[model samples]
Target: MTEAQRQIFVFMIYALIMVNFSGSSHGGAVSSEEEADRITSLPGQPKVYFQQFSGYVTVNKAVGRALFYWLTESAHSPLSKPLVVWLNGGPGCSSVAYGASEEIGPFRINKTASGLYLNKFSWNTEANLLFLETPAGVGFSYSNRSSDLFDTGDRRTAKESLEFLIQWLDRFPRYKGREVYLTGESYAGHYVPQLANEIMAYNANSKHRIALKGIMVGNAVTDNYYDNLGTVTYWWSHAMISDKTYRQLINTCDFKRQKESDECESLYSYAMDQEFGNIDQYNIYAPPCNNSDGSTFTRRNMRLPHRSHRIFRQISGYDPCTEKYAETYYNRPDVQKALHANKTRIPYKWTACSEVLNRNWNDTDVSILPIYRKMIAGGLRVWVFSGDVDSVVPVTATRYSLAQLKLTTKIPWYPWYVKKQVGGWTEVYEGLTFATVRGAGHEVPLFKPRAALMLFKSFLRGQPLPKS
Candidate 1:
């Protein structure tokens, strides 16, 4: 691969890492309490929760990590209910961004300062819904020391997040025994599984275990090459990429030989290379607004200083809800703080909120490969779901990645209809059932909440889905 192509692939590597993307080991244990305290405190930082709209913040006394999350009690029925934790992509995206504000949270935001609005179809009503800003770096979670952003990568994040959950559930012990499900879209595909794996492993290994029922990933980024190739075909099928261009690119383009000829440019430039914005080439989901200011990666503060999900553009706009949750989040007094990304790194430009991660390449894949097979061998159910429209981690890529399974097709592939249309489909093979969300893009919850929720509900019950 050329230097540029290598960087493009690197982007994919990090996305995989970020998304439940796993990586090499990080030294364990949160810094000592005294060390956490001695980091020159930003004390009295209150967590914000939604309803009773709670997106409240809390510190894990055990780990000295700060976590921000939203919770809902709208479920009139809480009898042995399943507690679902939803995640947004970005490896660093806020679940609160799409999960709470747009997808299944209890409330939605209005852009024009109309205040919080109740979602007519919030998912929490069926089950207790929760959204969290994990890993101490993403979303409202922060540390007094700027260097706190440095400990990123898959392994550390996975452990820290599990620690966070254990700590959080410890704090809210009432729901510890509740059937728990992990759900997310885009990059979260990796996050949900990896996190689920950790929870499952911990429960299995620990003396005092926990209950983690199942996991669900939507339009996930579980694999890179297949997802990318899937993108080429999906775009071509929809005329986004013409047949001649597709043929020319496919015939010459090669992942193994990215350093070859002009075909390298086709995959590098054509595959990515947006005309504007400095989003990581591998991350196809929308990025935080590009600041008009001439700031370099670190200079550009990702804080909305306004709305996180700005509805400034209306191309086939699905919803306009910037105002409702903007203050609930981006407007949080803490988020408005200045960018402390890199003091000595590039100082003129901007990077996304999770930009600090851009500095290091976290290319470590998960170590749970054997565990997955082990789970199936033990009669455990492992279901992986996909969204068809995601370009970053396309459905095609997921299919290609899982082909490695070579498992038997226990339940044959079939169309899964929603709203009387091709709202994607499903397939059950071996011990895994892979499904697709039609018409939904990367953030399946925001684009297709009902279908996504239905998928989770079915998985939780370990039962076949209802005919639409």
Candidate 2:
């Protein structure tokens, strides 16, 4: 069958299952009050008024594959708030590591690496946040079938994620049919859209449908070619790379193909050498972590527990060493027991990124623009935001990719304000919206918490960023 036919066939199969599967078969009447999953209090965690839950939801029973999740209800009226599913993209990264521990989650790891502090700007303030460690082999998530670790990619990830959501809903029936917003950053550019598509496809034939209302991605890798080209331009424009190397990168590299020619690779290496040079590529403008023991590789590799320390620079009231603290906190026996994690005593330590899974990523779509197009055409709210200083998947790349969609403008580009200061520029299109977070990096919330929170609140409300 052609690719289109194959997709249709797959959709039909899922549709048939959705049509026939009785809610009772999946235990849809299961009580939402999961007292066992409730997290009373985490070690070193501060007192909080909200409820928290963390555990594994088996996505594939035959393979014994399960994904770990941490859910934090809103500080106020959590049941009334929308359910926001947050994903972190490394194709192998753990959302709990970065999304929860450092960025928008309720707590930040203390410098002692054994304690936690409240993150005043946590996204849960606006919505119930659910951070997942997806696709198995990621963080505390795992698979009984060892091969599943090496055999994974976007499609498998999306498929398992859908199953996870369905099973998760069965567990938290209160959230059933609630408006759900899918949001993530980095490689999740692929995860969020693909999963949204799956949910939409499944909803077509199901009586109990997921109320997927909108999606938001930050500094996302939407189109590989644009992302690569934009990175080169960002480096050159910021004077991080020499003009000569910049020219070589633009002229020699063919990002359309996954593999670059040896000549292109050489030029790219030179460009990277000039640009990185002890600087964190994720945040070009931020200071480098001075106390590096080389324990963290970077935010991208944060999922791997055994990977190097994160290159964190103290800025904007954010802890540079938060990942180290998270590493320490999660590994504590008491903490794990409190969170209901590591039940089977997996052999490997939890990491931020899975090197094995990363190496074995089976498929990557060159561009998720088509998926975005389909989602927007389906009338689902679509928003893309970028941190101005992120070199990994800079705002320039997002601009170029969105331009390719040729969306009509609903609101002309304008500056968005927060606390009487310019947060960023924003523009609304017929089917999508784009915004930038000034002075932020790949992880916007970690770098510019206030601005990121403002942006997020607006996105969740389906409103434009504040004009005044």
Candidate 3:
């Protein structure tokens, strides 16, 4: 062949190679970077039909801070599904350990950490699930600047998370302008609303706005005064504590203050240690994880450090040792390699919650109600749900906090059904909806998987909970 002909043939071959390299190995539309992040399969994970991607997204270049994320696309019609961002809050919890592994994502790590099993009620059936380990100190997400861990607070966390999302979307530009919902539990009540507020602010300035449609938080921490009062009431009403202890908790504990007084601290310690002994505070009725030595990791328990001595507690329909399983599984060298995590090899074991960051979380808004009011008025779908059996951030606390909103009732309180059973009760107000999952714990999905999945489906469709 002539030189000209040979050159033309070489160009054609290069173009073909480029096409093959740019597209996903599995023939889906994905960037080379995305393909690199894709998990062919996790260690001992059950054979799954859907695709999974996980890795880090750098949020702050100056500090070398990066956040880890796991994307579990829907098992069916993934491209057509909307995106749901799930955050599990300890103000320092790893969403991967709690949300992705236990609550909403498709897989549940076996007790032995030997293999994985499919969760029949995983939320990914209805939406693309993205679990993020936010800020700089939690899970595999880390920072070169150790001070970042100590200086962590609501403001910085929100800012960094917004940065993470913006950069993450750029990395997976396919999701730009897609319907997005922010959902979480516990302290995520704070993280969800704060992040939503930031997203709104970002949209106002940027041309490529995030399509943030709604937010759903469960057993969340809302108003401080109301939460404190309501928690005491719940303890008394549920018979968790005696009448005399309840009165002392009510009178001595300064609910209005951000920091508890010495007397208040003593009273709380008394109630927890003396009265409520060795119980799973996250789930009032559920058995504690068999491996647990009585310490629980939670936001409410964060304050009372005496009672909350450790991290990685577990509960629910499945074996109670799941957290231990996750701890063992994620820390495995092979598991980390498969996930593309711990690339920096930071010097710390992977715990479900970060003790350092949880203790040092600097600023917290006493009330998230203002953000709720703003989002509600902004025409965003806002839903606050509670697990009735959770004592930490109980149903009563959620009720009291929401009652302060004074939203007009759009739908009266009613029982919502799932599989012809009374799954939960729900009330739709003018701008918000409040629901309680019957017998669910702090981690709603872990305790009531069917009901939580149904709740999620209804939320995504912007439909009311099934009345029948």
Candidate 4:
């Protein structure tokens, strides 16, 4: 590349770094009841109020440029708060879907119901919460150029996310010197660390000062090599796979062996054949909704209760209340308007995260891992949590990803207690911690709101989950 071109590239990257951070906007979009206005701010989304103060941060507008909208909220205390930029993992999922709606956010959507519910515990109470619909293609955030998809990879994604932070800080100048943390789960395992590392690097190079602290990932897709293996192991351990099937996969499904087949066309075919036939990963939980495909396949997304993925069938939920809510809400136009989800339109159809990206695409794993390691080594508090029950990117898969890290255990394994009772499991290696939500499935916040909130709160404080 020419020198001018390289400089341009760097300049654009620098702009990207600072683009998504904008300050407060007109708050009227989310209306409220006359009395509720005293409490809630956002309406469609259950305005679960955090104790902290709130505001909006904007990026470049979507009208022309690739950089679209950015949203930010901070704890309104004079003392700076640790900032966590939260991303949800769907290769195409919305961060607001899980991080805001279900997990640590102050608000939650009612169980299969259209309306919002209050979460007594919200992660934002402890730290400033930042949620994003990154990569433009995901949520309200959009890119005018389709070619932007070419930027898909660990490195670029992280770089832009970091830039978003710098820009966010620039707008909310008050947070300029605050300790910043990056946290997310699922595919974000790759996103959070990569971005956190870039911020660390940027702070070092820039004449201007930037304070970056730590990172946390819950059920992130960290390591590719062992992730698949760990997933299979989880299925086998949970009795989802039979012994013969496990042994067969164990004998053939090897990452090293698969890597050697780089030039061989049949290599991936053989590995996949060995993989897909084993117990369905989604077998961990029943299909959450239909697969959006045919019945022949277990839903590729989170499993629901009764539906098959193939037919896109709606499962007869076992929870009578949830079932009634689902039935009633599905028929209600106002409720459908509230969820405002992806894929399905006003008539909200309950579905798992569908195949939203190109099948054969790019991965910047090599570049991304170094950044993750840097964040970890730099004493950035990192946390990875997951519901053991999620079949898609199962908790076992997360465990397998972490096992590849080889980080020494800083905190020994123990049941994370919640409400004076053991809620689930937690462990720490060096500064990175991992936790499991016992009965919770794919969406931890929706299924295990309290535990998820506790997990988020602990991350904000850079402490372990409080023992119940």
Candidate 5:
């Protein structure tokens, strides 16, 4: 052959080799048509303008452990929007049940407790939302290895979650290299930071890295000692417990050590007995759910007799039994098939929170402040929000925990407005931001959807909370 012909042939061979290499780099070519994971229609879902996908990402192939995720694309310009992964912290909670169904997802459970309705203020209006059921044995995600089920903890959870994200991106290659945000509430204070740290480490070592840009955690549990102390203070300040009980609690309980003397336990119990009398500890201002007889209490007249009897009431059109509704909706055979869930037909039923897993959770970090400081220093946007009214992981706890960081104020604390009304208070620091959702409980979005959306949109835009 002539020199010109040989050169042309070599160019064609090189192009072919590059194509193969590109495909192999992404673990083989992934089809854009993810029909297998698409939701044709949920059982009673309202007509929607956006697409939804739900399925499992196998994190541990040998153990058959997988983390389940539900993704809702933005209502408009999904391709241009950033992706936010939302997690709910119980250390064992299902983000699908809490974060998706009740808080920020595109849909909410219907009042009848068996169907879904569109959440007018869903976060998907602003960005693509991804909700994950992590660490196996939570909600629809499961582990074939029983030991894996019982042996999960903070570090393992972060590792598995990171692995899931990498594989998930591979499955939905369109989202590869997209700007990603990690957001969660409660225990996720621990999960989000730990997972973000892991992602940062992975990005440093790998050729393909997740474009994690920011993290936001709301009503989070950041430190054990501060959280506990704040709880007692909140209870007393709210007049839920007696002053004597409060003083006894402070003096007797060694929150830092996680050890309580026998007398401390007695004082704690007494304080709780006064504080929880027929009240939902999660939301102090909300009314309690009534029994079938329309009575709010049991016949025995005991103070806080049965915890199960403490039903959640509707607060600002939010239903506490939304978890129960989601449980019913997801367990339907048709719903599972439509979402591509329960592929193995895991023998166990799905629940909002796994009692076993929560009980068995190991390695509870006393504080995640160090992780936060590291991430902030690394230039990742970090925002912490709190629902001022939530008794569980209240705003006071978050304030105390953040005080540990000793961050200087970049912007003086101010009230953030929504629709010409004060929605919440916000404070901007050198490396972190703190905000509160007025009148919101532990689940901020559930109680204050409009305010929550405002906060989320601000976070995504890297703008301060609305000042008007």
Candidate 6:
């Protein structure tokens, strides 16, 4: 038999043996089926005061598609805190890896991936955090129908996510009417607003409405034209690319068109490959992650920077190889057993982002500004933030995008503080708020956890960032 056929046969045999454990793992009695998802404790985990749960919610029964979620309740008052749903956007990134493990989630995996340490500035202190691995094929989420993995788009993903939320509410009914916020970054610039639109539409006719209060997206991709233009400009301004390359990018690339010309693609390649050095484009100042052999790998070689959900972790200083730690931890058989993940014995390793979905992402709205307008008009609190150092989706791109809104300014731009030091800058518009984290990168919380936490707190309170 051919090696390919032999591997298929082995996978089939393993799948049959794993059938008994295929469904969501749950055994001991509890208040609800969600008890099945309650993570009593993770292996090598430190003692924690908050409750945690990780499990799958079947969003599509016909396709047998399920989305995985990890909920970390607030450390203080779990019952009274708001629920914040976080998604990391690669079109196919695992929020469990980025949002839950590296950024806002309470624990950080160690270098060996054998133990966990607490993130002192975890967002769970401000809200009950739920990190979702969405669109069926990312992370632990999967579909019995293989085609579902190849055919996912914004519309279907938003619909399935809405369905997941509704069913998840059924599993944990206590959070039915709780205050909620939709949050994400990067390609989730599409996921967050689109899902918010779906929820708003659902609430229009249904008696049971999700109490969604606000939404906050950081370093988000809102408009293709502005994002592309701003990215090229950022590259030039940051001295990453030559003046000649910048001029070529502006003259050759048609930012308005969804598909760039071959000439444009070539120029982009030249700028990135030839001019840009072995530095992290996500954070220009941060050192690039080195391979296990201690050789350097540029962000482009590892993964596309802005387009993918690759992220970094910081405790005292940033660890460039932190994403590797998540890959190591989640791929472990015992760790998967602990988190109740990978029950079907899927024939693949866990990656931070899925190249398949990234390549096959069916429909992307050229601009999400219309949805932003609608949300603003509807009086939902909206904040668009950026990390100043993130060249991938820089502060300038966000500013250019928001300029199109042209809302009257409520608060003029000014520095905001976290302990007498400048945390970032903020400017509140009539309906929307725009903020910038001082030295943060694409993932704000991972770079500036305390400032990100302060931003989250202010967002929750519907107040402006502190000017003191």
Best-fitting candidate, measured by lDDT? 3
lDDT of 2 by residue, 1-468 (tens): 896666456556644543454364444543544657889899888877677898989988897998999999887666578999999987687788899988999998787867788999999889999998888999899999999888788888999999999988878876887899999998898899999999999999899899999999998888877777777788788888888888887887786767678887677666555455766677776665444665433443332111111223222224555566666778889989999999989888877767788777777787899999899989999999999988767898889888999988999999999999999999999989999999898899998999999999999888999999
Off by over 4 Å in 1: 1-64, 243-266, 271-317, 320-329, 332-353, 358-361, 366-371, 378-380, 419-422
Model 3 lDDT tens row, 430-452 = 98989999999889999899999
Between prediction 3 and prediction 5, the one with superior lDDT is 3
Model 2: how far is 300 from its true place, Å? 8.3
Comparing 1 and 6 on lDDT, the stronger one: 6
Better of 2 and 6 by TM-score: 6
Which parts of model 5 have CA positions greater than 4 angstroms off?
1-33, 293-317
Residues 99-131 of candidate 5 have per-residue lDDT tens digits of 998899988877565667788899998889999
Number of backbone collisions per candidate: 37, 14, 0, 23, 0, 0
The reply for model 2, stretches above 4 Å from the true place, is: 1-33, 292-317
From the highest lDDT down, the ranking of the candidates is 3, 6, 2, 5, 1, 4
Pairwise TM-score winner, candidates 5 and 6:
6
Tens-digit lDDT string for candidate 4 (1-468): 996666456546543433433232412222322112122233345322232222222333442222222233432332345766678765555565556655666565576465666556666556677777665455444445555444455555566666666665654554666777777766776677777767777878897667767776765665555665676577577765567676766665554331423323243334335544433232235443332363443333331111111212222222212333433443455533333322123122332232333221245463235565677778776677887776556787677666766889878999988888777898978857888888776556656667777777777667887765
TM-score of each: 0.70, 0.89, 0.91, 0.69, 0.88, 0.90
Which stretches in model 6 have alpha-carbon errors above 4 Å? 1-31, 298-317
Instruction: Give candidate 6's TM-score.
Output: 0.90
Q: For candidate 6, lDDT tens digit of each residue in 241-306?
A: 999999988988878886777888788777777887666778889877777798764322322223
Q: Whole-model Cα lDDT per candidate?
A: 0.55, 0.81, 0.85, 0.54, 0.80, 0.84
RMSD of 1: 13.8
